[model samples]
Target: MNVGLGLPVDDPAALLTWAKRADAGPFSTLGLLDRLVYDNPEPLVTLAALAGATSRIRLQTEVLIAPVHRTALLAKQTATLDRLSGGRFTLGIGVGGRADDFLATGLDVHTRGRRLDEQMSQLRRVWAGDAYGEGAGPIGPAPSRPGGPEVLFGGFAPAAIRRVARWGDGFLGAALPPRFMDRLFRDVEASWKEAGRPGRPRLVAQTNVVLGPDAVVEDARRNLARYYAFTGNAAHFVDGLLTTPGRIREAVTGFTEIGADEVMLYCWAGDPGQIDRLAAALHG
Candidate 1:
């Protein structure tokens, strides 16, 4: 299976370092997370910088909260990135659950799913050279590939899984066990078939990773605790991270066994050295 790495948004200075290392390493994609009320690098902006820095690695938004931004603007931004990256950009989008994120955007959290559905349709129109409105012209500079970047819908609910067939080119699953991921992947495939979609939806799964010395591993755990505190079960996530080479290999193998097209390893520790370690663990 194709393997990807998630950028450490906690360290902006280390982003380019991670980008260059991942581009030179065994990674198929360099991805980052998105959060409105948190201290995280904005995916598009950071990935744009990364696109200029790396010529090989594909850059992706592991899952950008779609309803948080305007559709036309989002389309223009993604198209520009795709052009700059030479068609190596993948748009992983979802309707986020965090209420604080919606509050910051002045949007009703409960309505985000509907808003994202509308945005998905709007994004296609905007990218297909359609006018923005009755008088507004089409957004400038289309994406490198037709239909803009391939969109991967991320979420676990039934509606979210259904989005894979309705609006997305694939399903971007969150960090979860093999059984959960397998069930969701099956659901995504079932939805695609039920919708009369041809071929299977691209299936990508994510998991937290941190492999290094005691200090580095501990740091990752601490950061994860705070990062997932909103979940009210931070310990479950913090303890579930793949902290060893054996765990990493097992996770990748499990995902591959489940028929995932790609597995994105999320780096909680903002250290470029993790790239080599990852390569050694997965490729050796």
Candidate 2:
């Protein structure tokens, strides 16, 4: 299995520094998280900068909340990003569970899941050079990839799992245990066959991490606590943090053993040096 690094979205300076460094070698992809009502930089805009900064590393939104954004605009933005990035873009999408995000964006929280299903189909038709609805004609700056950037669905809900077969190229698993991820991967494959998709869906697993001295590791724990505080179970996420080379290796191996095509380590420490620590840990 290949390994990927998740960029720390909270720090602007560290973003490019880490992206350029990771591009030199080590990680196969650079992932980012998204939240509309947060202090973190927007994933698409930040990744556009990374595209110019690095030539090789793949850039992806680990799970962009697709329902909040308008379909036509998203289609244009994603296609442009994919073209500018030389086809090194992957759109990992989900109908987020956070209500504040939807409420803040004037979306009906209850309708997002169904909306995302419609949006996914609309995105494909737009990317295929079909005249957009209302005779807007084909949106220019077509995606570098044939249909669009590869789409990977995230979430454990049945509808979300079914989306991988209906519209996505794969499943993007969240920070969950290997046993859970193994079952999710199997679920995605079974759903794919049930939907009559030609081949197995790509499976990618993600885990939060930071490998360094006690200070950096603690910084990560604190970050996770603040970010996931809304869950009221932030302690659970903090307790699962991967902080040592041995722990990182175990996490990677655990996911790989479960048939993950890629394991995405989300570094919360916000330190550029974490990339080196990750490379060493992966090699070790």
Instruction: Please provide TM-scores, in order, for all candidate models, with all chains considered together.
Output: 0.98, 0.98
Alpha-carbon lDDT, every model: 0.90, 0.91
Worst 10 residues of 1 by lDDT: 6-15
lDDT for each residue of candidate 2 in 29-129, tens digit (9 for 90 to 100): 99998898888888899999999999999999989999999899999999999999999999999998889999899999999999999999899998998
Candidate 1 Cα lDDT to native: 0.90
Question: Which candidate has the top score in lDDT?
Answer: 2
TM-score, cand. 2 = 0.98
lDDT, candidate 1, at 69 = 93
lDDT value for candidate 2?
0.91
Cα error, residue 116 of model 2, in Å, equals: 0.1
Q: Report the backbone clash tally of model 2.
A: 0
Off by over 4 Å in 1: none
Colliding pairs, model 2: none
